[model samples]
Target: MSSGGFHVHGPHDHAVEHAAQGHGHGDDHAASHGSEGGGSSMSKIAMFTAIVATVGAIFAYMGGATQANAGLLKNDAAIKKTEASNQWNYFQSKSTKQSLAELARDLAPEDRKAAYQAKVDRYESEKNEIKVAAEKLEADSHKFDRQSEEQMHQHHRWAQATTALQVAIALAAIALLTKKKWLEYGMYGVAGIGIAVGALATLHI
Candidate 1:
């Protein structure tokens, strides 16, 4: 029952959102100084931050979505497992009936023997059917569990990508404030790393 809204649920998601918003206007103060080259640099960094922020937002949304999917799928797994248990219980009951019928067949008088043997045969057939159903349910449960685990892994990748993007945004903000060329380089490097991580997430690596 996951919906379309991308609410910031994680602490890291909040941080990325805040960083994204703050950096969009970060160059304003730097621009007021009116150094032409510096102004251009500040503007470019601001734009970079904006783009990274957009990517981070996407990553955050994906993280939330995958997390929700993981939970839902895990619930499905649990439900299936419970159903499998019930089937097993049913199988056990049928087994008990079969045992009782077998005993009756052995102990019954000659005239009644055919009736008890027929009951025993019917119970055995019913037990086989229940066993097949129980095994199928157990297999289904395992499949759901595996799918849930994969979704959780994807969620972690998205979170990591978002975090990296947030760091890049932070660097852009600092570089904008200080007008340091090395910090700008650092910002670019971190931004590249963030995008690379996002690619990994996209590939589900």
Candidate 2:
């Protein structure tokens, strides 16, 4: 307080002040490192989530396509079945006409008998042709039914894969929050299963 009319700190006070500043700097450095570490972990989790989301979207699209195909095949099968039934009805109508024609031939005069017989023969031929067409339509309907069932199975597999991927994404979020390595590993395992199922669906298994 002498020459410049200012108060001066002693050596001990200066030392104490320097120690306090050192402690503050140490705390700041540690806080910075912690923040950096947390940010890195969050980035890693975000990257993994992005990958899962991309894959899940692909699987969901595939599932929708398969389901639509199945519906189309089912509709085709229904159409074919209706066509086959119509053909069978036509055959039955021809049978009824043939029966009436045969009865008329038996009851007709000798001069008209040949005409009625010709009508009966024509009806028989038409009935045979209708039977063939109806059988073919039934076969086609069965084929369509089988195809629809196969597509539905593929759709189910895709659905399962998509669900598994969603669960994995949720688990990954939990792992990020809790910082648990085991949870992270479990997420990877579920994601692997989802991928495997998706591959199976692609192969139509």
Candidate 3:
């Protein structure tokens, strides 16, 4: 018991203090362990996010490059087509000149008929030459068109791969926020899918 300046403690009070001290130590130990685990999880998520972003950037760049190449090839096809049209026009002009020479031969006097016939023969040869050139130009135009189509197809694949990677990154952000074990597993699975798609792109599938 406590009088004027003296204080007294009962057995029950002492027991209560001991129990509180024990609980305090146990809580501190658990908290410290939990903080270490959370730090590790954060580091893992951050590193994964960075890697996925870098991969996505590379995919985006490849997609743009393929698209540009396709456009250039298509332009080449158009230019070739124009050149072929010009050649066909030239061939037509030669045919007209040949027809005129043939008509003159038919109506000319016997003495002058030979000269007109010679002109007709020369015009026929010129027409044949023009026809060959026009055909060659058309073939070149077709080749360019085929090449352009292939490039466009490749660009589409790259775009698809890039999209998958972006989705994976979004999932990673969600997992990081939630800190759920299932979410972490989901994040990994999505990341794997994204990488597989990227491989398909590289293979030109």
Candidate 4:
């Protein structure tokens, strides 16, 4: 009787131990699955952030290029304006000489009047040529001014786009740190605005 009881008790103890080990294994597997899920989520976030960063860099470069172009145009406009002013001054000087020639012709003695009249005619013709040249320079100056203004407007658009992209990058970083879905959506929205502005800049709108 004692030998039979020991055999039965041994089998019962083995069964309980096996059950406990199985339970522990199940818990470990569940924990491992949880960790894998979390890691996958983090990997996805990192990939999205990398994509946004690349786009942001492109936007920044475009903005810089636009600003450089605007500066160049502004300088050109200023130079043209200076040239126009110089031409106008020259026009004024020619007008003064023409007036002086006319006055001299009116007051000269009758014998010398013909020579002074010839001087007056030459001065008038030169003055008309100078006026036409001065007007052309002023028109050129105005054309440059319009082009510079257009470029400046484009620069402003590019700058706005760059700013929006920067904000989106910051938001993406925040979303990664916090693991918030809503923040990620917000980041996308800002990035969309940036892309739209960049497109508009390219169109010169």
Among all candidates shown, the one with the greatest lDDT: 2
Q: Compared to the true structure, candidate 1 yields what TM-score?
A: 0.82
Estimate, for each residue in 1-205, the C-alpha lDDT of model 3 and write its tens digit.
7889888889998999999999999999999999999999989988988998998899889989989999999999999899999999999998898899999999999999999999999988988898898899899999999988988888888888788778778877888888887877777787787778778768877
Q: Assess candidate 1 and give its lDDT.
A: 0.89
Identify the runs in model 4 with alpha carbons over 4 angstroms from their true place: 1-37
Q: For residues 1-205, what per-residue lDDT tens digits would candidate 1 score against the true structure?
A: 2358754367787899899878866766566666878778988998999999998999999999999999999999999999999999999998898889888889999999999999988988988898999999999999999999999999998998898889889988899888889989998888788788878878888
Instruction: Summing lDDT over every window of 10 consecutive residues in candidate 2, give the lowest-scoring window.
Output: 1-10
In candidate 2, stretches whose alpha carbon ends up further than 4 angstroms from where it belongs are 1-41
Indicate the residue-level lDDT of 107 in model 3: 95
In candidate 4, clashing pairs total 0
Give the TM-score (vs. native) of candidate 2. Answer: 0.81
Alpha-carbon local distance difference test for all models: 0.89, 0.96, 0.88, 0.81
Model with the higher lDDT, candidate 1 or 3 = 1
Locate the minimum summed-lDDT window of 10 residues in model 3: 196-205
- Sort by lDDT, best first: 2, 1, 3, 4
Q: Compute the lDDT of residue 179 as modeled in candidate 2.
A: 86
TM-score of each: 0.82, 0.81, 0.82, 0.80
Model 4 CA lDDT for position 92: 84
Which residue runs does candidate 1 get wrong by more than 4 Å? 1-34
